[model samples]
Target: MYQVALIEDDIEIAELIKNKLNNIEFLSSIDIYEGPLTYLNSGKKAPIILLDILMPEMNGLNAIPILLEYDPDALIIMHTIKNNSETIFQSIRSGAVGYIDKQSSNIDYTKVFRSILNGGAYLTPNVAYKIVNYFQTKKNQFNSLTDRENQITDKIVEAKSYKDIADELNISINTVRMHIKNIYGKLQINSKYELIKLTKSR
Candidate 1:
């Protein structure tokens, strides 16, 4: 079971997300906060955080740096009304794991919640597609790798453990390790931490 923190000012929106998350398979619990600072003060390593962009005291974008300081691995999903490039880029740069728009309530929040609950991520289709295109345009840095290597590299970027990667890739654990070792050598990074930072920063 995963414990999720929800920080949104709109009570209705907050409740909606809570209800959606509560129905998710892995999310057994969700702690809702109507303000950004309240959730920030909780100081818990919630795998998922739904944070609103506009809030009293500290906005979500401003609060992101502080939240990262509290839990570097926190998977924060910007719960906001805005979907502009400026807001999206700032949130993504500040280490938000994903984005969710209140105005986008008409969409399938279930899929969004489920994706984030799992090791994958979520954003509205348009936003997510743009982000993917952005990443793809910048994927030239990884062009040195073959197709298989690229897939393995993406799994590594997602922070999958070697055994889990093997299971997902339908390969032997030893083969996974070999691929990982080769990935490390090719990427010139020795640790998962380094791989994530390097890939995500690009």
Candidate 2:
């Protein structure tokens, strides 16, 4: 059973999220915290934290590390109306694996709980599209991308042959294929078309 901690200042929003969590059969308990101090005092080991960015006493972003200090193994999910690249990056860097916007698809309890239960990240479609666009704009900034992969990316832009790219990069055709696969994973593009569209936009 997963323990979910929801920390939202708005009484209505907190109750709504709490009810959603309660509806899920996997939740052993859904604890509500109006602020970080109360949550810290409660001393709960939360598997997933559904948090709002704006709150009184302490904002969600600032409170994340404190929450981690209370429970290092916590999987915090930023569930808020604020959706933007900077916030998304900060949330990711601050140890949040998921971000869901309240403005769009907030009522989708299935997607929300599925993300919590499967140990996978989930975002509202609007937020997901923004992330995809962000990836499109900055394809090469990936710390994981290799020089060979960049060469492939250039060829991908040029619409050159994979065999040629493999030979030029002095890697086996299969190795070149693997590099492209890794590049795609880092970029979060589904297909060559998306890669072309996204990369071209850069």
Candidate 3:
């Protein structure tokens, strides 16, 4: 049996989810908190936590690290109506083990809980598709870069100045600058910072 905590500001939705979770055989208890602050202040811990994205005090994305600090072993799941790719990836990067779309009608709470307890991660089908598509798009953008542009991108990511890259590659500074500009265009990014972030994400 496992205990669970649900942090949601909407009382009606919270009660509905609690009722549904109560029917899951493996769940030993379900506690509801109106928001992240309330949950944190309670000093309670659970094996699994269902967190809402939009709330008063602190949003779910910002609460992930704090919740993990409170209980590092807790499996936090984002239960939100927001399904944008940015928010999904941010939640995952912030340490959420699962992403469940609150508007998704096909999710089986019992199965979701069981999977997390068994050391597996879960995401709603649409959310999974969005993540897959994002990587695929990034891959295509990367493949579009010419070999020279690829080399310049590597140097830029390494924080090499245009003059340094030009000297190392035995090319003129003007050539290096042009290649970098082309790399940025191919990657659809504006600056070295964005380029570095894109490379690291890959």
Candidate 4:
């Protein structure tokens, strides 16, 4: 059995989740906090933390790092109504291991907790679809580029000069410039900074 901490500003919702967690066999206990500040002040560490995004004190996104700092081993899961791709991706980038949509009807506390405990991740079906779609879109964007254009994109992302790329590819500098221009067009990016951001996001 594992202890869990839930940080949500809504008292009613917090109690609801706590009741559901109470029924999970793997969970030994559940502590509900009205906000991140209360949880952080408590200095209590749990193996799993269910966090809500919108709160009067501090948003869950910003609280993620602080919570992790307090207990690096805690598996934080975003339990919120916010299901947009940007928020989902941002939560993941901020160190959350799972994203659960509060409105998802298929939430199985047992399965979710078990999966995370066994070194896996959990995402609501809609959330998972959004993540998959994002990668597919990124893939399609790359696929639109020719093989040579793709190569030049990599070189540019590596901070290589146009002349150096030309020397390595055995092409003239102007040819290298042309390929880069095509890459930028295909990727719909204006500069190396954007190119780097796009690639890193993938």
lDDT of candidate 4? 0.91
lDDT of 1: 0.78
lDDT of each: 0.78, 0.80, 0.92, 0.91
Clashes of each: 0, 0, 0, 0
TM-score of 3: 0.91
Per-residue alpha-carbon lDDT of model 3 for 13-44, expressed as tens digits? Answer: 99999999999988999999999889989988
Best by TM-score: 3
TM-score for each model:
0.60, 0.65, 0.91, 0.82
Cα displacement (angstroms), candidate 4, residue 111, comes to: 0.6
User: Residue pairs in steric clash, candidate 3?
Assistant: none
Every candidate's CA RMSD:
13.3, 10.3, 1.8, 2.9
Tens digits of per-residue lDDT for model 1 on 1-202?
Answer: 7788888777887787788777777677898887767876776668777788888867889989988888888788887888876689899888987887667647675677667657787788777766677676556556666677778879877778778888888999898778777777776679878777768767
Instruction: For candidate 4, write residues 119-192 as lDDT tens digits.
Output: 99999899999999988888899989898888888888889998899999999999998887888888888988
Best by lDDT: 3
Ordered by lDDT, highest first, the candidates read 3, 4, 2, 1
Candidate 4: misplaced stretches above 4 Å? 163-182, 200-202
TM-score of 2: 0.65
